[model samples]
Target: MGGGAWKRGGSSCRPTTTAVGEPVVLPTVTVEDVRRVGLPPSTANLQPAGGHVVLNVPVNVYAQAAPVTRQVEVLGFPVTIRATPEAFTWTFGDGGALGPTADPGAPYPAMSTTHTYTRPGTYPITLTTTYSAEYAIAGLPFQPVDGTVDVSAPAATVTAHEGTTVLVR
Candidate 1:
């Protein structure tokens, strides 16, 4: 009955709410969100634990990973995520493979995780590390996500030769 207001209930008791432009928009999460987390940088360190190893001898192979954790925003919420080295899989490149184990073999004396080469040859060793991921999103107690990702360390080269000892008189 007054300004450009619409009345309801067949009476001017209260005016209907007027449109106030478009509602504010908020960003939604997508696969691209993963890019923000990205694949973690190289974290594993792979190499032979001893200087020289003989054929049939268990050469100690070990890998280490750096600790990574950060609080990031995901789906417009604070998400705490952590990445840790879970296990390591080794490929001796000598037509043999080691383990996807959590054990990092000790030095020469103790071979916790090792491989025995049957013959003498130069080999390129590689170690692939699996990472365990844990995440907790703030305000979303029932929606927790967990997963694993793998990253490989730089390849290491090793030379293997038959054991020999010479004593001259």
Candidate 2:
């Protein structure tokens, strides 16, 4: 009880137990607490992960993050929260938008999250990423909060052109 008790400025799991020795689960974090402790999701300088994709093909787009986690004091408990990519919404810049893909999308030919160009042209593609965060306190289990953050990537151009095919007679 002395060494494992949770306290301020501490960063470890300190599980609480009930009178019957059953593990006491922390209540789901309140919506207000999420705003207080979690940093808004960020998609730094959004761009297609791979440049120069073909028309009518799947292109992979992704965001970069370094340990997307945050530590903050909630109410009176020190809490740790981690942000994870939940979905992606893409605007193809051609007056068309594709969206909310659960898959992070693969490269051409293997992309589940992709769009097709109808004409040969240069289009600016914009992507919005939705991030979901979970919180853990006093070594307790992590629980998802009713929090989400959407970050948009700067529009990057992807040129799509038609392939030429001529018959030799």
Candidate 3:
């Protein structure tokens, strides 16, 4: 194992293995570790600007998703963790929600993710981003981290208004 072992300071390091001969990576990267990195939350965006929309109509919504990479020490070993957006969940604040989907939606016209308001009122919009992570130790090949982490974006406010009919002479 001399040729394949990693050199740390002045000594050689090797991965431990279980009785069955499976490599047991020490300090395995976990969802908690990824969360501890405090990755940036995706920002929720809406079309039909000014925080207002028409009643009974579809409003466009999307997220500005960004991935994060960080370097940390796990049990004295240099570890690299990378978190990528894998899913998104949205709440329209009107008791309507869309979610856990791969599509982060798009701006007007694309209509990738839209919600229809049946009444005229004010609502708060929320988006939660789920990230899947992978980690590498000492420049070794990366390994998938079990489970995922969810980060909530800042809440946004929107008002849906009903149109009134007007007569012209």
- Give the TM-score of each candidate: 0.62, 0.59, 0.81
Model 3, runs deviating above 4 Å: 1-25, 165-169
Consecutive 10-residue window with the lowest summed lDDT within model 2: 1-10
Order of models, best lDDT first: 3, 2, 1
Give the alpha carbon lDDT tens digit for every residue of 1-169 in model 1.
Answer: 1123211112121232337844422223222232346545443333344335578766777665665666666435476656676777888888888777877555556667778888888887888877666554553332223446666777777777698676899
Model 1 misplaced stretches (Cα beyond 4 Å):
1-53, 139-146, 166-169
| Candidate 2 lDDT over residue span 1-169, tens digit each | 0123232332333366668988744444544444455444335232244456555554555544333677765546577777787777878778887667765565445545556677878778777777777778766678776767666767777787776555998
Q: Model 1, residue 169: what's the lDDT?
A: 100
**Superposed Cα RMSD, model 2:** 8.4
Q: What is the C-alpha lDDT of each candidate?
A: 0.58, 0.61, 0.83
| Candidate 1 whole-model C-alpha lDDT, 0 to 1 | 0.58
Could you give candidate 3's per-residue lDDT for residues 13-58 as a string of tens digits? 3576569988755556766767776688898899888899998778
Off by over 4 Å in 2: 1-67, 161-163, 166-169
Is candidate 2 or 3 superior in TM-score?
Answer: 3
Query: Total clashing residue pairs per candidate?
Result: 0, 4, 0
Q: After TM-score superposition, what is the CA distance of residue 79 in candidate 2 from its true location, in Å?
A: 0.9
| Residue-level lDDT for 127 in candidate 1 | 82
lDDT of 3: 0.83
